[model samples]
Target: MPGVKATALSAAILVSAARAEPLKVGGIDLDTPPSHCAPLRDAEVPKAATLGFVSGAMTASAVYWIHREQRRRRQPGKATHPREWAIWTRLDRKKKGYVTRKDLKSLCYRFESDEHAEHLAKQLDPWGMDHINFSSFINNFKVVQMMRQAGRLKLWHRCCGLGVAGNVAGHMAQAGEAGQESHSATKPAAIFSYYMPPHPYQVSDQQADKKRLQEFPVTYAVIDYPKLPGACKVQVEPELGLLVDIVYTKDRKRVDHLVPRRVAAFNDCSIRSLEGAEKLSMKKNWGFGSKGISLRSFPVDGFGPGTFVDFLALVSYMKRDGEVFQYSVKAPVRNYLLFHEPLLEWIVEQINGQKDTDKWEEIFPQLAASDFPTSSWIALGAGEYTDYGATHFLQPLDEVVVVVYDERVMPDGPGMAQVLEMFEDTPAPAGSVMLHQTFV
Candidate 1:
């Protein structure tokens, strides 16, 4: 009788432990709101219709216009013009080109001259080298300025890479669904984030409210991937994990076929006639059409959900002049440093309004030597700026070419497999978005 009672007590303790969940907020379970509560995030997508008829109409129109334009491109017998040829080449360079990420890293390293290296160290050592994190970016602006003056440029550069990658990856994991879809559900599918031990950046809407309960710092591991010419990326509202979240949109938009407006303007109409109207759509005026659409992805949220990191929305835009419609199969990485006036000033002095092959190498010393992140987001070209209210980001990848990872070598494509392997390689007991992980 005594043994049996002891056994029963043990069993009860086990059951209680299993039932001990993190906590809930507003009647919503922080772990998985959809399951613990009445509705799943994905399950409520149809309710997106409430975004209103006008928003729906605009979305439908934009979607239809995009599709219609695609159909028109299928119409054959169209001769390729020089302008179209140029756009295709740029798109091809970004998609199939030989440039590897290592190439960019090397460029960042090499871009720095002796003077640049000196500047970096000075920035990292603020307060006469006594203070840390002070002017280290996490600290206030005064400290940051002190560090920069002290030569800790490389510190911010490194932090920029990590922060940019984190935000870009988070943005990619979310799917965009107008205003109706709550932030808890679909977000923009430009990037995804996870963490080994969970840090401050790994906050999700689900756990946001519960932070005060457990009071543990949420960690974030950001992952980014590029889209192949044949694929698009979509965001999914799964319980957890990476690839599974990108269930449908792995191939929504590629470098889309564009209308040859420039050719139409110059060849079909005289340049003089277009001077006035082109001024509106011109790259100089609107900062588009100088190139085609370039696809990219970005992680708006630095981490998934569990902390106080600012909300980051993955963004996409078009450059009709470039003739390339880019989709950041993951979203693009945008950072504060790129928006800094000095950065633009540096670029303008280099380009000098025209290509000067001779001076190209001379300006190398001035370019910011950033370790760089997976700048999956797309932009036609640089020299344009706007404040979308984002802080701590990455940019200057205007000419940073990209390429596709072979899909056949390993399923889910190379990028996905590599990212998954990164998780497994860490052999982390970290909770997965989807629990389908296997150890090889």
Candidate 2:
């Protein structure tokens, strides 16, 4: 009877905490519900006065429960909505704990027309990712619903860039021996053209116009096949892509904060032939579908050691003529020379301080003039390539697969045989992000 009474008391406390008006205990606002508790407000609250008997023990228990609930709601990686969790479970029929566009599209077709289903799937996956975990699913669902109601459910765009960390084993030497000899290993270069401005910048002279046009390549469409521009040889540059939130200064001249939200596999596919290329970005993007990013991504709790990031590793392969070849040396993301908070700090410095040099273009002005996008996608750096990867250039119909997998699941990394088997299908490993792109 006492346990039943305690359960009832707990239920009443939860209801009181969901009330609109503040429930104060020693000036603490217990009724101020957490953001995730919006649905809780609709529940009926039993009057505490009706209980007829109030004990000191019960009052203390109520206060403790409210405080604990508040703390639990604020923790990272927690699902925000009950409805979204239910929807995710239904869509993830394979019990993979995540849903993909294919899953959503298949389910949507049951009720919506083919075209409508496709549009709904695309809108729900604004990032064009391969899989949507519960947290991302909830966020995407809310955004798409709001945009649909507003009649603006098109593609959501953000300004982003890549970091050229030259210290990843033999990556610097593989890029070019000259860069290895001259470039500082500690400082990474920033190539800020992952998503260019929608509109071109107006300039006075022809030279200035040309400079602005150089930064206008739309290169973030990684889910599609890449077109080989002209007869130039193209190769895939496998790297880790960080989806970060950018906070700009009030004046909008500088970046104040760069918080990384998720990490995924990315292919900063590049042109091997640099003829007439004055800057690095010139070889980076050749128009739409020139770069690649995995449809799958893992939430980043923190960048430090012993965090979620430490468990991940990067490896890549090339599928050619029905044969698979190892492309990149299997490397842990933590093996980078600069990572964690130091890596973020370096990126912030580069965004604000990088200038127009013969090798690199000015970045801050492009971002500033583009209204300072709130979010960015950054490819950290390419890993060292194997001899086959270093010598081979992507031919027509060659498919590149870049994977970021949890080492905790597969200690030795993903087997190439298994990778080839899953080449045309969804990645089999949980917590793995794969970027599969074919050259046309």
Q: Which regions of candidate 1 fall more than 4 Å away from where they truly are?
A: 1-110, 127-135, 138-403, 406-412, 415-440
Candidate 2 — which pairs collide? 129-295, 130-295
Model 2: residues with Cα > 4 Å off, grouped in runs = 1-104, 107-115, 118-156, 165-169, 182-184, 189-192, 199-231
The Cα local distance difference test for each model comes to 0.24, 0.66
Please, what's the RMSD in Å of model 1? 29.7
Q: How big is the positional error of residue 77 in model 1, measured in Å on the Cα after superposition? A: 54
Per-model TM-score on C-alpha atoms: 0.18, 0.61
Q: Once model 2 is optimally superposed onto the true structure by TM-score, how far is the C-alpha of residue 104 displaced, in angstroms?
A: 8.5
